[model samples]
Target chain A: MVPAPLPQQLADLSDLVGRMCTHAAGSLQSATAALLECRERLALQVIAREPELDALRVETEELARDALLFHQPVAGDLRSVVSTLRSAGDIDRMNRLALHVAEAVQRRHPAPTLPPEVRDDFAEMGRVAVALAVKAADVVRSRNVVRAIELDHDDDAMDVLHRRMFEVLMDPHWPHGVATAVDVTLLARYYERFADHAVAVARETVYAVTGEEPDAIPI
Target chain B: MVPAPLPQQLADLSDLVGRMCTHAAGSLQSATAALLECRERLALQVIAREPELDALRVETEELARDALLFHQPVAGDLRSVVSTLRSAGDIDRMNRLALHVAEAVQRRHPAPTLPPEVRDDFAEMGRVAVALAVKAADVVRSRNVVRAIELDHDDDAMDVLHRRMFEVLMDPHWPHGVATAVDVTLLARYYERFADHAVAVARETVYAVTGEEPDAIPI
Candidate 1:
């Protein structure tokens, strides 16, 4: 096939990022579902797919570097290219976090990591985390800054859930022993960090569009 | 003062990356010291310096982006700029991992996280982690591909330590409670991940110098 024009190549790159984002979102969703359901097969699938995400991340970085060298795109175009490159790292991190969740489930096998009392809280975390991942994918697909900007609120919710999980762990009356508590703590962190990466993607998207960071957003 | 030429600017950028690497190394060392000694004040100092790392990271990234737009360097120079940008992220992550170690220490102030039995293991981990980080910084400063390539071996040692830690955790006679186990798990992860980031910087430095990834290096 004949190579397309530079603009077309740029579009292809953006599309590739979108596809990767969708894959990341799917991975997190499936990983969480597997964790909740104790499905080893699903969790294994998520773990296996992580290499694909790593490959895609490498391709994205290579393509971005090539575009910089070949097109020398400047200003907004430059920002967009940089964002595409940087966002791949964020997406890849989300994929790794998802894999961590999957591995946690796989480690416990048929046994659920979460206890009965805290299952609902983690379930809520999984829901919000998957939703936030999907929203992040949507932002990449549409390049809609408004939707991208809304990710922070979802991320904040993830944080609250994270804190609540910690509170449960630190509670004096906590019934779960150290092993289960450790699992829950790590699981909570995986979800929270996943959400953090999603928010990072949003921030990069905003920076790409505006050439400035979101208001009061820390580096 | 007059702004430096592009060559000088590029050198300045690399110097900045080196400075950031040193800071990251220092943070890891200090944080590990805090963990080992259970010194709240030292841990607090490490936490307080994290913002400085964040600022340095942002500055390195900006300098890299600006250099790209203004200088449009190609080939090795372009790779250098990109490496500096990417390596800054690695360094920043290392700093964050260090902060986690420090915070873990601060949270359990006046009491060490690792039990008497595992304290020696973690102390060894801290030592290896610090050494690996220093080696990574040296590679960055010198752009020595051979030295950079050796980091994988150091990283391998870290992985062994990490696995040894898990072995202890999973042992039938393991005596530490879940909270302490969780703390040790996270601390081990922090060290292993810090080493991983250092290896990443080494890999990037190798690529920057040779324009090719090291042979047989698994992604």
Candidate 2:
């Protein structure tokens, strides 16, 4: 088969990145829900789906390399190709965060990881994470710098939720046992870091578009 | 100035990567000591040194691209050049982890982050992190696949230490409050991730030499 035109190649690359983001976001949402709701089947499904994200990352990187080597595209074209690689790395980390959530759920099995006291906090964090993931995917698809900047606001909410969870953990009258405290800390971090990666993708997306880091405060 | 020979250029690239690894390892070691010892000055020093590591990564990437474009290296040479880029990413992450450690220490200054009970554990974890960073730098310098594989053992010990720290966190009648628990969890994770990044560098080094992954288990 003949090689596709440069625009077609770029389009294919963009499409692949979008798909990867979709997979990563879906897996993260499902995994977080599994942890909160104790859905073993969904948790297992999330675990099984990790390799797909890994494959997408590899495919995107290879395509980016081939585009660079063959086309030797310069300026914006070069930035787009490089951004594909950088974005793939960010997406892959998001996927890994999703897998960790799944594994946390799997480790706890029938018992829910979040106890009743902190359950609402984790639920809110999960909602924020899912929202960020969805927005991150959109940013990858559209490269809308403004929308990418908006993700920072969403990520801020995640941070607030994370801190609230810590408040409950550190309360003098905290009821949960140490095991539960450990679980909560890890669970909160998973959501917080998931949001952080989304913001990272957005930052890189902005960089790709404007060829400079967006004005969003550095993480 | 005259351009260097192709082999000389490759050697220079390797030398630069080795230096990055050294700086990354040194920064990690200093940061961990500063954290365990509650040395604000050293922590500040670690934080200040971060930009140098970031600059090194950018320089390494530029050199790799220049080598790829100018020399058109192929086969093992090409693999080595590509590995430089990949290894640099891993090393850069290790440096970031160090920065996080320093920042943690700085964040909790005037009072030790680790309480008396878990201080020893954190100290040991810090030692393991430093050892792994040193070994990682050596692997980058020598491209010795055997030594690279050995780094896995160091990582395994880090994992064990992390688990032991969790055991203390989960124990009933734990004395420390929730904030300390949070600090311990974050501290353990920082060390664990630092080790993981070292293993990633080792894996990339092994791949650079053998064109295939070694028998070491994936992180």
Candidate 3:
């Protein structure tokens, strides 16, 4: 049997990456729901899915390696393979970050990980994070440089939410004790990092298509 | 002009990666000092050096790409170049994590970022982080699987210090307000992640040499 052409393999790699991003988004969404609603089942589901995401990442990377070895692709094709390899790593980290959020919920099961005062803030942060992941999947699937560039601007909302969480945590009137403060701070960081990885996926897509760094491109 | 052979190019790649790890170790040490002493000059120096580290990572990645293109090495040589590319990214992130620590110092300068109670803990954490980076440099330089595997155990000390910071923050008699707690939490995370990147570098070296994941190798 003949091997698939290099372009076909590259396309398959992109499809796998897009699926990984979608899975990551679902994980974050479920983890956030668990955090807000104290749903241990949802949190556990996210945790259980981590191994599957890891397997996907390994598979994507191997496909990339084989393409390089068998096809010895040059120029744009080489860039796409390299970018796919890096983007798989980013998407894998996104799932890991989501798993961290789920673990936070598990640690505080039956008790809300998010405090009442900042529940709305966390809810907003979660929405923004899920949106970024969804957009990242689109960018990976379509290789739309314009949409990829938009992810940077889209990430501003996550940043604002991150800073807002810190402000709420540091308020003089904060009633929650140090333990809760620590949880909130770490949880906020996880969501912020999840968004950052989504942005990184977008940047990798942009570079694969344009041979230019996302920031260097005139938007 | 005669281009260097594949073996020589691979050796140069290893040397470049070793330097990157060493540079990362130095950055963390300087940043830690800045945090401990509230030394704005040291913090500024770390910040200034970020571009140089960034440049080094780019050069390392380009060299890896060029080697793949020109030599088209197979088997272990190909693995070495790919691992070098990944290790350069891990080292780059190590430098970025160190920069975050420096920025934290800069933000809280003239006012110590660490409270008196947790000052010693931060100092110890810094030491462990630097030691891990230095060891990682040696492991990358040598490609000794045994030494690479040892980094995981070395990281246990960092984890202990990280948990210790939280214990201090959560102590009922804790005097510092939420602001200091936030700063300390983020700083601890930065150091922990820096150590994680060091461990990752070691793991990559192990994979390049053994064609096996580090964890799968029986000690």
| Model 2 C-alpha lDDT per residue in residues A1-219, reported as the tens digit of each score | 556677778888887888888888898889978887899899999999878887777778667766765676665676677667667777887888889889988988888877889877877887888788888888888888899889988788888888888888888888776787888888788788888888877887787788673333453
| Prediction 3 global C-alpha lDDT | 0.89
Better of 1 and 2 by lDDT: 1
Native contact fraction, candidates in order = 0.43, 0.38, 0.48
| lDDT accuracy of residue A29 in candidate 1 | 86
Residue B48 Cα positional deviation in candidate 2, in Å, after optimal superposition:
2.2
Task: Report the candidate with higher lDDT, 1 versus 3.
Answer: 3
Of 2 and 3, the candidate ranking higher by lDDT: 3
Question: For model 3, which pairs clash?
Answer: none
Ranking the candidates on DockQ from highest down gives: 3, 1, 2
Model 2 over residues B27-135: C-alpha lDDT tens digits?
8889878877899999999999988987777777767666766666665676677677767867887888889889988989988877888888888887888788788
lDDT, model 2: 0.80
Taking every candidate in turn, the Cα RMSD to the unseen true structure, in Å, is: 2.6, 2.9, 1.4
The segments of candidate 2 whose C-alpha lies over 4 angstroms from its true place after superposition are A1-3, A213-219, B1-9, B68-73, B213-219
TM-scores, chain A, per candidate: 0.93, 0.94, 0.97
Tens digits of per-residue lDDT for model 3, B1-219: 465888888998999999999999999999999999999999999999987887777778777877887787777888888888778878988999999999998987888888889889989999999999999999988988899999999999999999988888889888888888888888899999999989989998988998875446664
Models sorted by TM-score, best on top: 3, 1, 2
